[model samples]
Target: MAGKLGRTGRWAWGGLLVVPLAVVGFAVAKPVKVLPRLGPAPIFRLVDADGRAVTHEQMRGRPVLYSFFTTSADDRVGSVMTRHLLALQDRWSRGSPDAASPTPLLVTITLDPERDTPARLKAWAERVGVDPQRWLLLTGAGLAVKLVVGTGFGVYYETPPGNYDSRYVLVDAAGEIRAVYRGPQLDVATVAADLALLQREAAARGAARLAYAAAHWFACYPVR
Candidate 1:
């Protein structure tokens, strides 16, 4: 009986060692690098360019990218970001083999809704060659826009002075804000990588899912 107990102790120690070894291995090798879950994205309800009501609840179960831009004929940043996202199809699809749909939805919210009505947004969409099915340009009452943009997203948007910031937010399928990109220094590649990480996590299962959870718990983020 003593020998049996000693063998059991050894097995227990072996099991204990596996966890630390796994943590160390994850830290060193980083087989999975995940974007830190920032927080829950704010729930919002607004109107799409087609006068259709869209809500945060509606976007659940799908990864969503959100960008804010005031209605401006000269604001090339929005169009540039759109073009970059469109060009990143191959990059997003690199590892997502079983992703029911590899391409995540893009949502662009207009800051100047008072001037940019549904008709104007549709026209702007056409002007920029935006695919309405994939990308949604949204606008609503000025107050509602302010509530969602300023309070929810913490983005600054005001007219008259035309002072605003260029930014993009990456939200996971679970409606969690995983990553945020801002300023002129930010590029699409960084967002793409973080988003790929999110998508991979979404489609992961079994041991792979456990590995990703371990990666997250261990803070095994990729070196940037």
Candidate 2:
């Protein structure tokens, strides 16, 4: 009777181990949805630094890092943030030769449209060493779009007369607004890590889609 009890205890312990292993295996096999396949991205019809009309549809395929700020209120911190973003763009652009696609797009939309004119944006770009082809400084006609986009991305700004603050928004490749980096004090390392995660997520999704297509094709022609 004692021998029989020992054998049963051993089987129970083995069963416990096997159950968790099976659960882990099943979880590993499950597919993960990288980026929310959120319906079409929000539309924006803003004027670029060159005074040309640019739309959200035109920027679909590439990831966009958007920084929204006012030039009039605390240009020093805003300019510093812009320099960091430009540095990031330079780093990524340098890796383009090895990458499947070129550098990601950067757009700086001004909340203080009244002051941030095309000429001012051009000067700011030159001061920060921003590439014209990769970085765009956008300004819109009315305050309504600014409020709408800002609120949607959780960017809080109180532009009462004679006082202002800063807010930055980062949009991913799928055009989905992924993060809102607030305040004038921006951490460069944190921003870089977020951008890296976005790139990895996008690449993983692309790879999964390609694999799915290949599997579907093979199913139609088995033993090929």
Candidate 3:
């Protein structure tokens, strides 16, 4: 009788362990949850390096990655980030021949208008090897640009003297601000993963949003 009882106890214990594991495995298998939307992107019109007018309307229906920088010699983060943004496209957007679509466009706006006119931006673009087709270098009325970056995009910056924060803003296809990265916190892998998640969410027709909300409710963020 004792031997039979021991076997029964062992089976009970195994069932207890397996039940929790199965629950965890089910949670892990759920669809990826995305970051919550930050806010609506601000409206603005600016000129690109090629002297063409660029507006928020034109950018609609496409995801955009934004960064504010100056042509000033001290702002090295701009160049470093430019390299990272380009790599983001090369690594993730350019998938196989059957890739669905290219990655989001990277928009770099100059905080210094006096020094970063369209002509100057064009020169800087060439010097930095920026592909005009993929990356846009924009400069316009200092106040308008400042308003768009500061008030519209919610990025902090000061004009005239041209001082600004080094940060990146990721906006979804619907012109909603989604993710923001700053300073050393920027991670290429994280950004790429988030962008892919956003794309999937946009395509999910409302089902993914509910799943994401459930994940958030359960505090199901991935462990580092």
Candidate 4:
């Protein structure tokens, strides 16, 4: 009887471990999809590389592609990511003569305020080929606020004294959080494609507004 009890106990312990492992495996295998939509995006204020205060409210009426980063030891991925962002900004800002309206706005917010000063951010921007008119790099005061915003956007960052991970977040014009890319998981081609979608959306919104205005004006004049 004692021998039978020992065997049963072993099986019970093994089942306990296997169940949680299966659940975790299934969760990892599931795919994540981020839908593109317009809504009131979360609000935050930070000082830009030019020492100017920038807020989400100021970015309203325009599509915003927001990227969040920290200047910690794990910032090696940031240079490459920034390059991709700058390329998209250049492409969108130069209005296609064949196309109507301007492209979306690009905003980069630094998570490490203690280390990423205005001078440092400006130098980084130059290194990453950021255009002053199109791309704005910002930094904030405390980690608490940054963490709260980052969490709200589904961006994760870890700093183990000397090590860190870079994360990026993309927000749309209607103030809605759209996409989040972490570390080296993102590529230049993907970033460009995402920006193109945003540009098209912005153009459509602009056209709708112009049409409404024209209709109102024509109604008032009643052309003979």
What are the TM-scores, per candidate, against the unseen true structure? 0.83, 0.67, 0.76, 0.61
The true-versus-predicted C-alpha distance at residue 63 of model 3, in Å, is 1.5
Residue-by-residue lDDT tens digits, candidate 1, 1-224: 99999999999999999989977888788888898888888877888888999999988887888888755766666556666656554344454434564567788888788888999999877876667766788888888888888888888866531667778888988989888887424566777677677878887899999998888888877677
The 10-residue segment with the lowest total lDDT in model 2: 215-224
Better of 1 and 3 by TM-score: 1
Best by lDDT: 1
Q: Cα lDDT of all candidates, in order?
A: 0.78, 0.64, 0.75, 0.62
lDDT of 3 at 27: 82
Q: In candidate 3, which residue ranges exceed 4 Å CA deviation?
A: 1-31, 96-98, 206-224
RMSD, model 2, all Cα superposed? 9.9
Q: What residue runs in model 4 are displaced by over 4 Å at the alpha carbon?
A: 1-35, 38-40, 71-74, 93-98, 159-166, 182-189, 195-224
Q: What is residue 207's positional error in candidate 3, in angstroms?
A: 4.7
How does candidate 4 fare on TM-score? 0.61
In order, how many clashes per candidate?
0, 0, 0, 1
Provide the lDDT at 23 for model 4. Answer: 54
Per-residue lDDT of model 4, residues 138-219, tens digit only: 8877664355455555455554223344556666656776556675455656655565555544554565645434333333
User: In candidate 3, what residue range of length 10 has the lowest lDDT sum?
Assistant: 93-102
Ranking by TM-score: 1, 3, 2, 4
Could you give candidate 2's per-residue lDDT for residues 1-224 as a string of tens digits? 99999999999999999988855653455333232232444687878777888888777777777776655535676767776776767776666422764357887777777777778877777776878888888886647545545554445555531333455666776677656566566666666665665565556566666643433333322111
